[model samples]
Target: MYAGCFLVLSLISFTIQTETAVYIQHRMGWNKAYCMLYFTHGSWSLLWPMQLLILRLQKWNVPWQPFWRRHVAILRSTAQMIQHRTLHLTPRQSQQSPLRYMIWTTAYVTCALTVAGGSWYVAVDMTTASDLTAIYNCSAFFAYVFSIPLLHEKVRFGKVLAVAVAIAGVLVVAYGGKAEESTPKHGGKSGGGAGGPDHDAKEPQNRALGNIVIGIGSVLYGFYEVLYKKVACPPDGCSPGRGMLFANTFGSMIGFFTLCVLWIPLPILHFTGLEKFELPTGDTAKMLLVSVLANATFSGSFLILISLTSPVLSSVAALLTIFIVALVDVMLPGDLATPLSGNAIAGGCLIIAAFIMLSVATYREMDEERRQKEMEVAESEVDEDEA
Candidate 1:
């Protein structure tokens, strides 16, 4: 139930973020990609604080000292679980602080995520819209590939088919009919929505180079997701509440890192005159805020979803937004008359079908894991009684 709810939230907020990002760049003429990325990601630092506030309000009658202590303890235990990658921990292990380790891990992981995201910003101007959309969404396939070794995920036929189908749908949507036309209306450059502003008809600055950059970004993006799942998430069987708390806390760490460490680049970019810093005014500021908040919501929810499930599932789930944003575009003021193409309908159906298929496979695997764990516990208890 929690998974379903967060999935929906992530998809909706992502759509909003993508639309606002496009508007900021295209309509407002503020093509400051790095600045937008920084703001959106930096907002993640608020996740934990916001979550803490909500939790406190829920337990409003509780005294501060006990409430704070209990909250800290839960986070601490979850952090330990993340560090050790196990549910059970020894007393000594529990006492040991994973804070320093988590900090170092967060630093490197954030670097990977920043670079992966930066690639999209850099490539958007250089590549064709269709190429950018198709290649970046390929991260879903990479996620599955990385899962085998990093996550010890078995090679399941059902999962393979689902992932393949999802990618096929993306291609159909991206390059199906008039690869140039349909793709821009649906999947955009950053794999979110919308191609570059409105000048996509122009020749790409360097299509070959852009594809290579985005290709690397696709692989790195997949790696980042799997790394987060392995290094930050508690092991299977963790309570949903605990998982949610930890996920937001980790998201805040990423946001806080962006705020502190990532600021160094802004001045450098400004000095280089590559992307001069400028404050957005009036409607741009308002829309930018909306975009940032939407991105924060989407990022936090995505982290929670990944924590609660496998990275493969979350990556594929994100693909649903491509179809959703397309539908949203159809309803917008100027494009209301532009109905979805036959290819769009066909591709959307394929993506949805793939999601359902993958969901069933994942849940079945989780259930089997739960039953196996229960059997192990029961057998251990019987052995102890006999002894």
Candidate 2:
């Protein structure tokens, strides 16, 4: 059941990411600063809706709460109810361990910092939608690298080799030169009237800076997943749902506070008419709305998926997001043209292959562990009966 849910979550995430990329490409302007701000606030805003829904459901007799206090209340009520109905043994459960809290705190802090820094940098620097997608895709590489050491997870050799191929594909997509085209106006003067043809090129320096910022942010976020898996999955008597709910609440609070601190100087700078930040225009508003919804859904579902399964599987499944985005880019009108170079195709195939190999290897390992545990249980029963 959990595995099926993860697959569904992955598909939903892919759809949302693809739509976000399209919206950014078409409706949103090329201002990195405004884009980053929109994404930052949008992501934080999702917590309110999620919390409201959870609270409402809980009030209506939903057995969803899993945190310290809530879990105790739930167990106590359940015990009382059962005791009234019939006679049975009552078992006591231990309190949540300190290590779990520490892991959650650490993951939340790191993720918040990463999102703030990355979004700010991207907003200031990125000029094109394709650049944004390419940079975002780098998260997979980071995830692959960070998961092994941080989570004590193992990866197959084929998976490593596939990651290299995927990286190569990214280079082809990023640096493979494409012809510049004029921006299409919807219903206005065909060309510049008073001024000659407008050809304001984005500064190379700003673009480079944006890439660096988003890149680092992606790496931090990649590790964030591994950390979440560790903290959310306790050895015994821990509720994954409750842990996630708390993490989201705590993380969002931290994010909101950080954004407030970060935005403090923005108003001052805007007052001086120096930074000159304004709300997005035209399709930008629509894009922001879609991106926000998609991001929130994917993020919430992803945490649930992680709790239900292992981090390695979640990470591997996440790689499919790239394929989804790329496919969407091809299918949508006005989407960026994917260059059909030999290297590009080869690189894409390699990344897909790598994800498949990793998934298979991880599944085999899990199955083996399950079989071993079953065998041990059977042996114990046999010895008891003989005695």
Candidate 3:
């Protein structure tokens, strides 16, 4: 039953997020800065505290007073821990400072920039859903690469296999050969427009550029995830729940700050005629509303996933999105040319198979470790009795 619910929610979040990204970029014409501002500043992001609070009270039956108190204590503890050299900024034991705080906050800023910037590029440059998704999903590869050196985690055969297979799948989906041209879902014209063949000729170049941009964004975000483990988690002083609570609050505060600081750029850009800023309206407004709601749900679901499963598994679960997004693009049209290429299907299958292999390996290893620990404890007890 849990598995079923997990799948359903995962599918919903991935589908909505993919479509929202595509639609916003291809059709919305909203600037990246404005998009980030709207998302983070004095808006839904600021309300994360209240949103998380309500979730806590409703789902865990946690008392409001206790929850509030725990949040306060955790914030205090995390600060002291950081100040006292108890918790470093990263696995390298780098010291924390106001500068580091600003740097980490860039994770949030960069996150916004990547999503909005990448979407813009994809909308204007990329030709298919497979291309957009294939590039976006490369973050899993980035995560694995970063994890080994930065986190100093042990390398396992199964994990290596999983990563290899998943990456291979992405390559297949992307390069497996183009599908027959059909009506673009979001109405990107290739064969027509004022420029004619000269315009059409640029499509391949633009798409290659977009793919590169997306890949870079994927690398940054993969590091962001590792940073969360290495630097973002408060410390051993706070319980997992409490750590998460203040982390959410801390992020909201950062978002609020970003909202204010970001205003400096929009007017400059607008006046300079670099990128025009406009409030979303009409279909754009409606689309944003849906995206925000979907994002909120995704965030909440992600939080739940972390509690229920390891972050690594959670990431694998997200990898499934690339497959779903491409499939959706094929089955349902929001905007894009032919998405269901033969290569994409075969690639998606490989990715899914990789995820399953990883899951089995992870669980099996965990169980073995648990049993080993139990045996050691039992042996120690028997020795004590004989004495």
The best candidate in terms of lDDT:
1
Model 3 C-alpha lDDT per residue in residues 1-387, reported as the tens digit of each score: 343365458558546754664466545655353443346233425445675667686758777788768766555556445344365345333333344564555456445433533343333344344455455556666667777886665688888788778878876765566521321221110000000011222345566775566566667656655555455455443355555554455445545655656556668878988568777788877876665555545544543443334445555666666567667777664545334767768888998998898788867866887899899999999999999
Off by over 4 Å in 1: 182-194, 335-338, 381-387
RMSD of each: 2.1, 9.0, 6.9
- Give lDDT per model, in order: 0.85, 0.50, 0.55
Ranking by lDDT: 1, 3, 2
Q: Give the Cα-based TM-score of candidate 1 against the true structure.
A: 0.95
The estimated TM-scores of all candidates read: 0.95, 0.65, 0.70
- Model 2: which ten-residue window has the lowest total lDDT? 186-195
Ranking by TM-score: 1, 3, 2
Model 1: per-residue Cα lDDT over 1-387, one tens digit each: 999999999989888988887777777888786888788889999999999999999999999999999999999999998898888999989999999989998899899888888887778777877787788888889989999998999999999999999999998887776657432533322233334554357777698999999899989888899999988899877899999999999999999999999999899999999999998999999998888888889999999999989899999999898888878878889743346778877888999999999999998998888899899999999999999
- Residue-level lDDT of model 2, residues 1-387, one tens digit each, is 655674676456546644554345444543334334435443654664577576666676654454446744543432232223222323432232333444345446445544633453333234333354355556556766777886666776766765665655555544444412222111000000011112224434456665676566556656666665554333322354544554455445434554544556567757786456666666776765665555555555555566556555565566555445445545656544443445435555666676667667666777887899899999999999999
Q: Ten consecutive residues with minimal summed lDDT in candidate 1?
A: 185-194
- Name the top TM-score candidate: 1
